[model samples]
Target: MDNFIGEIRLAGFGFPPKGWALCNGQLLPVNQNQALFSLLGTAYGGNGITTFGLPNLQTRVPLGMGQQGGVNYPWGQAGGEAAHALTTAEMPAHTHALTGSAGGATALGPANNLLATPAAGALYGTGTDVSLASSSVGPSGSGQPHQNMPPYLVINYIIALVGIYPSRS
Candidate 1:
């Protein structure tokens, strides 16, 4: 089947087919590949006057152009991270509860009174004395960039260098 100029496809092989070029963000001379240059322009990358760049699909996934589901992704816009480290603000708000006896009956005279209303001369007792504390959780993880990519099979993305130019309907 004939492919339209600038059309991209996945291939399992290392090399591109006769009329296709690997989409590795390589620059091509305008005088040589004028047909592809006319369609692609410098949307991907290039000097525009003497050279134009093919779409770079290396370690990147292609997203549909335009807005969808209230999210606007303009054409040729590339933005994303391979891994993300969350900040304290991103975590849920919470507190830690701690409870323990301030002292035994021997040290505080008796365990009959609570810490709030301790025995006359005693410091504290093994009574209802709950200590509440609030603190931020310590950071975890090795701070390494985890693989953000989904499970995928390796493949090469190739663009048609020579083909029929498409027209708007």
Candidate 2:
């Protein structure tokens, strides 16, 4: 039966050794120890070598997700962690303040006199020119949201590798 062994041939400079041959049948010297090898039929397989067509490439193969903790694309954490969205209580206790009105006595008209002066801590901003600068200025109601918080998931991935095949065998 006819069989073939894939050969790695080299190109450029000098002739190949006696046993090897160029796919195109061109005689050349190939220094096995140092010569670059190409998957051409040129290299001599000698006695066991048979002549046959190249094999078809495999259709499918699996890839590593890098979660293996070994060298792989998208290298990072070996797996993923479970987590959920923060509830209203979970959110950092904080407040958002509104922009204060520009300060200036001239801005206040005759009406500025009718207002009474507020005691310390009772209110901020001057008469007539009273603005949102007051400590009371902020979102009202149970600014605390509903307790039913939605779920949150995180998957960290970055790099990807493709188009890799084994060398001739």
Candidate 3:
């Protein structure tokens, strides 16, 4: 089949076939690949005068151009991180409830360590000022970045280097 110049496709093979170059963001001479340079320009990255760049698909997936659901994604735009660390604002709004008894014989419950006793006889103790201990749960996590990418299969993205030049309708 005759592929259009600059066309990109996934391949199971380890190397690109004849007339196709791996989309590894390598710079190409504009004078050498004029047809491809005309279509791709330097959107990926290049001086644009002597060199042009191929779309880099290494360890990355392609996303359709334009907006969807009010989110705009212009052509040749790259976004998203391989991993992310959640912030306090990103966490859901919720609270931890501490429950237990104090001053009574059964005050030695799980939450008794967090309970405080002020003024001995005020609650159920002797006529002495006794203050209980204050406790809290330690913060969790070691502050590491978690994988943010979805499950995906590995493949090579190859672009056509020699093919029919595509024209706008």
In terms of lDDT, the best-performing candidate is 3
| Model 1: lDDT of residue 29 | 94
Tens digit per residue, CA lDDT, model 1, 1-169: 8899999999999999898999999999999999889898998899999999999998889998999889899888888877886666877998866544555434344366434434356554568866555444555567555667788887999999988999988
TM-scores for every predicted model: 0.72, 0.16, 0.77
Model 1 stretches with alpha carbons more than 4 Å out? 92-142
For model 1, the local distance difference test gives 0.83
Better of 1 and 3 by TM-score: 3
Q: How far is 104's C-alpha from truth in model 3 (Å)?
A: 9.7
lDDT of 2 by residue, 1-169 (tens): 2113233333343443443333332232233421222333332222213332221111211244454557555511122223344446756888775443333333234463433334233345466854676556644454443444246332221111111223545
Count of backbone clashes, every candidate in sequence: 0, 7, 1
Stretches off by above 4 angstroms in model 3 are 97-139
Q: List clashing residue pairs in candidate 2.
A: 15-28, 15-29, 16-28, 16-29, 16-30, 20-44, 21-42
lDDT: worst 10-residue window of model 2: 156-165
